[model samples]
Target: MEQGQAPNGLSSCYRHPGVETGVRCTRCERPICPDCMVGASVGFQCPECVRNGSGTGHGPDAARPRNIAGGAIAGGDRQLVTKVLIGINLLVFLGGLFFSGLVDELVLIGLAFDPELFRVVGVADGEWYRLLTAVFLHQEVWHVGFNMIGLWVLGGPLEAALGRVRYLALYLLSGLAGSALTYAIVAPNQPSLGASGAVFGLMGATFVLFRRLRYDLRPVLGLIVLNVLITVVFREVIAWEAHLGGLVAGAVIAYGMVSGPRGKRPLLQWGACALVLAATVVMVVMRTTALV
Candidate 1:
């Protein structure tokens, strides 16, 4: 017999009796197969031990692991929200391909005439949903590809660190902040669309998260600098306003997520997000007032 294997089938996994395994759960000492292993801070734990939060030598009353934002550490796919967002963006892109009007209807516009609709239509005309819909809108293949890659790269870590709800809030609010700024500053008749705003927001949040964790800042800083340069150099084609808005909003929100008293973390974090949203609303209202 192999080393560490028990005799007479005693080494079989408790959860999978038919499968023989020499590995025992670190928490309960029960034989566990590779499929049943759940990584912990220490050795691998069984599913039951992880589920009950009893693997850390603490009693059953011990709290489950939590992320930086006080969210329960999720098992399995940590980037689920990021994946869903990408899927939605892709679906919208596909829909736009078949229905040409979909892009015009969803793209961000402060005020513009829709020839198809035979009337004036835009955010200023009370199409408030455009503020959000525009976030998922994309016309060019390159645009969507670039934004999706950034989302996959930067979004995964932030979602894992901040948890799903908080990360979703950050992403959406950042995108809205970008749209609001574009609406407020750009010509009312001008149009814009893309997920760059949200992607830039994630970049900003990644910077803050890395700083909080005391990781090497050079990589993130370099990326931010490079992107900012690209925005500046291509300011004529690029919506620098959206990028700027997202970056600032993301950093501010992430700071709120990582800083402040631990006792009041939830209140502080959500309060910061609320403040950003309120500010975006104000920008939209003020711009609409001016346009109309």
Candidate 2:
């Protein structure tokens, strides 16, 4: 042994005693060679820690799945999209309070789902945006507040699972389905505007996403049952038709996204979601044609 070096068995790399590197695993605190070191948030980890999933061997983003080619976390955070959605809904509702004619022009006459509009004005009337705009409208303070709460509760996890683009697609498609159904079933002139349809869609999306991850479905199932009960008990007030439409649309879209093969998951999942949105557009066209 060299004069300055410790004895071979006393304090040397576990994998390479001849080498002088004195690094150790953050988790196990055992001597490790650079070859065995895995980058962790605070310090280096060992292969054993990586294999055991005991350490996030990259950083806080390590736990999130990353795109292999791009190195970006697949879903990132849920804060920005959900907050923006809530902000828009609140701003519109607030504007309606201060401006006497704003609600009539933007929501009731403009955005609320009304089959009669299609019948009287025709699809070329530029009122087609109502399919989505109505999802952001609310009749009362509690209405928007309650719906925003649902969005915050359910949007975070779903967005984290599906990523921003897909999450937004699911929400809009589900809302479209809800409004389409309402237009199909409700009286032609009846005005209906609320985020209940989109909110119900979030619930359905959450249910399907959890099921894909093989999570405990009991809590999700319970929430679904409770909401269904509320819709039934308060059918007159709830627009149960819209809720059912959004729920079915969300579940079907989620199933399509989750059931794809591992290799083609992203491509197939997004394609399936796009098809759902396209189908909703067709429904609107057909319904408007028939009504007109």
Model 1 agreement with the true structure over 118-202: per-residue lDDT tens digits? 7888999999999899999998899899999999999988888788899999999999999999889999988899988889999
Which numbered prediction scores highest in TM-score against the true structure?
1
What TM-score does candidate 2 get on C-alpha atoms? 0.70
Q: Give the TM-score of candidate 1.
A: 0.80
Give all TM-scores, in the order shown: 0.80, 0.70
Instruction: Please estimate how well model 1 matches the true structure, expressed as its whole-model Cα lDDT.
Output: 0.84
Candidate 2 C-alpha lDDT tens digits along 1-292: 5332466443466667656545556444556667877774324567865675433346664454322111233433445688888899999898878877555444422223434333333122457766677788886988998899999988876765565777788888888888877776675556678888888988998887666544478999998999899899988887887899899888877776655544576776677677767777776766666665
Which 10-residue span in candidate 1 carries the lowest summed lDDT?
54-63
Candidate 2 off by > 4 Å: 1-64, 67-71, 74-77, 108-125
Query: Which lDDT value does model 1 have at 82?
Result: 96
